[model samples]
Target: MILENEIGLSSFRNERQKASISILYTYGFLANCYEQFYKMHGMTNQQYNALRILRDQYPKPVSTSFLREKMLDKMSDASRLVSRLSAKGLVVVTQNPTDKRLVNILISETGHQLISDIDSDLYKLDDLMNGITEEEAVQLTSLLYKVRNSLKSTYDNTVTEEQVHA
Candidate 1:
C-alpha cells in the first residue's frame, strides 16, 4: 500500500521523512486494529497492556510508578487505569500497610480468567504479522532496534544537558 495515498499526503521532503511518517502511520493503524479487537472484549489497548503487566507480576503487588515505566503507551494515566480495572473487579488495589503513601495493585482471579479467555484471540491477532517470513520479521525487528540505538547518543547528550540546567 502507498503511504502517501493512505495518509492523504502528496509528498515528502525526502525518503527519510517519508519513512518516518510511514512508521508513525503504521503504528497508529495497527493500534487501531488492536483497539477494535479489544473493544469486543470490553477493554482498551492501554487497559489490556496494564493488565498484562500486572499478570506478569502475578501475586506481587505493583505500584503505578512501576507500571508507568513498563507501559507501551507512556502517556497513559496508570492510577486511573488501575482504578478502572478495580471497578471492573479485575484487580485489587490496596494501600501498603508499611507506608500509607504507597498504593499497590494486583490482578485478581477474575483478571486471570479474563486473560485466559482472551489469550487465543490475542495470539491469533499477533499472527497477522506472519504474512512476513520469519527471517524478514527478525530483520525488521533488528533494524527498528538499530534505528532507536542510533538515537541513544543524541538523547543521552540532551538528557545530560537538561540535568546540568536542573
Candidate 2:
C-alpha cells in the first residue's frame, strides 16, 4: 500500500516529508516484527542484540558501556539488560579485574544454544523483506548510509559551532 493510503493522509508537504515519514513508519513496522519474533524465544530485541554482540566477543568479556555503544537502540539500558540476561542464565557477569566499579559480560553456553535455536527460525523475520528485491535492498542500504552521513555531518557541525559560541 502507498504511504499516503496506509497513514490515511491525503498528501504530504513534499516528497522529502513523505520519505521521512515512510522511513519512520517502516522502522516501527520492522521493529514490531523483530519484537514479536524475539518475544517468542523469551527475550526482548535489545537482549537479543546484546547476546549477538557478546557472542561475537565470546570468551572475551565486554563492558556494559561497550554493549551500549554497539547496541541498535542507543537508549537501551545496558546494565539492566545485563542483569536480566544474567538472571535468565543467558549471560555471565563478573567484576572487571582492573576496575571494581565496572563489570564484564560474556554469553554463556545456554546463550549460545539459544542463539543457535533462533538462527534456525530467523528466516521468518527475513521473509518480511521479501517484498523488496535483493538489488533494491542494496540500493536502499546505500541510500540509508547517505542519509546518515548527511545527518552526522550536519550534527557534528552544529555541535562544534555551539561549543565554540559557548
Candidate 3:
C-alpha cells in the first residue's frame, strides 16, 4: 500500500518528502513492536539495549560513554539507564579505578539469563521481514545507506562550536 493509503494523507509535497515521512512512520511502527516485546519481559527498550551491550561485551566493562555511542537512541541518558538497570539487578556499575570520576558497567548473571530468554523472541521478531525476499532486503539496506551517507556528507562538512574553538 502507498504511504497515502497507509496514513490516510491526501498527498505529500513530492517523492522526497514522501519517502522521508515513510521512513519515519515505518520506524515508529517498528519501535512500537519492539516496545511491546520488551515490555513483556519487564524492561524498556533502552534498558534492554543496555543489557544487550553489556552482555555482548561479556567479561569486559564498558563505560557509559561507550553505551551512549552504541545505543539505538543516541539522545537517551546512559547514566539514567545504568541507574535503572542497576536497580533491577540486571547490571553492576563500578567506579573506574584509573578514573574515579568515570563509571563502568557489566551485565550481571540475571541479565545474562534474561538475554538468553529474550534472544529467541528477538529472532522471531526479525522473521516478520520474511515477507520480503533476501534480495529486496539487501536493496532496501543499500538505499538506506545511500540516503544516510548523502546526509552524512552535508552534516560532516558543517562547522560546529567545538571545531571552531579548536
Candidate 4:
C-alpha cells in the first residue's frame, strides 16, 4: 500500500510534517530494499554487511571499532555481528597479535566465494536506483550529505536518545 494511504495522511501541515514524512518514507524504502537485497545471499542484512566489511579489510585485520564506524546502520553490534559470521564460518575473529586488547576480523574463503557469487546479483539491486539518472544519483547523494551535515546535532541527539531508551 502507498504510504499516504497506509498512514491516512493526505498532506503534511508544515515543515515538521514534511520532515517526518520524508524520514518515514526514506527509512521504510531503504529497509525494504535492504531486506530484499540481502535475501538473495542467504544471509541477513547485517550479516551480509559484516561480510562485506571483512572483505574490504582483507589481508588487513579490522577492529570492531573500525567496522562500527564504517557501517551504515549505526545501531549494529559489531562484536555480535562478527561472532555470528564466525559461527557461520564466513569470518574469523581473533585477538590482535600486536594489540591483545583489540580483536581482529577477517573474511574467510567461504565469505569471499559468497561475495563473488553476489557480485552479479548486486547489479540487480543497484538497478533499484535507476529511478534516478546518474547525475541525479550524484545530486541526491550530495543533498543527503548536506542534510546530514546541517542537522547533525538534531539527528545525533535523536539517535542517542533512541539508543538510550532502547
TM-scores of all predicted structures: 0.90, 0.94, 0.90, 0.82
Best by lDDT: 2
Note the residue pairs that clash in candidate 2.
Answer: none
Q: Per-residue CA lDDT of candidate 1, range 1-166, in tens?
A: 3888888888899998897788888788788889898898999989889999999998899999999999998899998999999999999999988989989999999999998788868876777687799899899899888878867787999999999999
After aligning candidate 3 to the native by TM-score, how far in Å is the CA of 68 from where it should be?
0.4
lDDT of model 1, residue 28: 85
Pairing residues by index, what is the TM-score of model 4?
A: 0.82
lDDT of 2 by residue, 1-166 (tens): 3888999999999998998899999999999999999999999999989999999998999999999999999999999999999999999999999999999899999999999899899999989999999999999999999988998899999999999999
Error of 1 at 120 (Å): 1.7
Report the Cα RMSD per candidate.
Answer: 1.9, 1.4, 2.3, 4.2
lDDT of 3 by residue, 11-76 (tens): 999999999999999999888988888899999899888888899898999999999999988888
Rate residue 43 of model 4 by lDDT: 82
Ranking the candidates on lDDT from highest down gives 2, 3, 1, 4
Shift in Å, residue 58, candidate 1: 1.3
Against the unseen true structure, what C-alpha lDDT does each candidate score?
A: 0.89, 0.95, 0.90, 0.84
The total number of steric clashes, by the backbone 3 Å criterion, in model 2 comes to 0
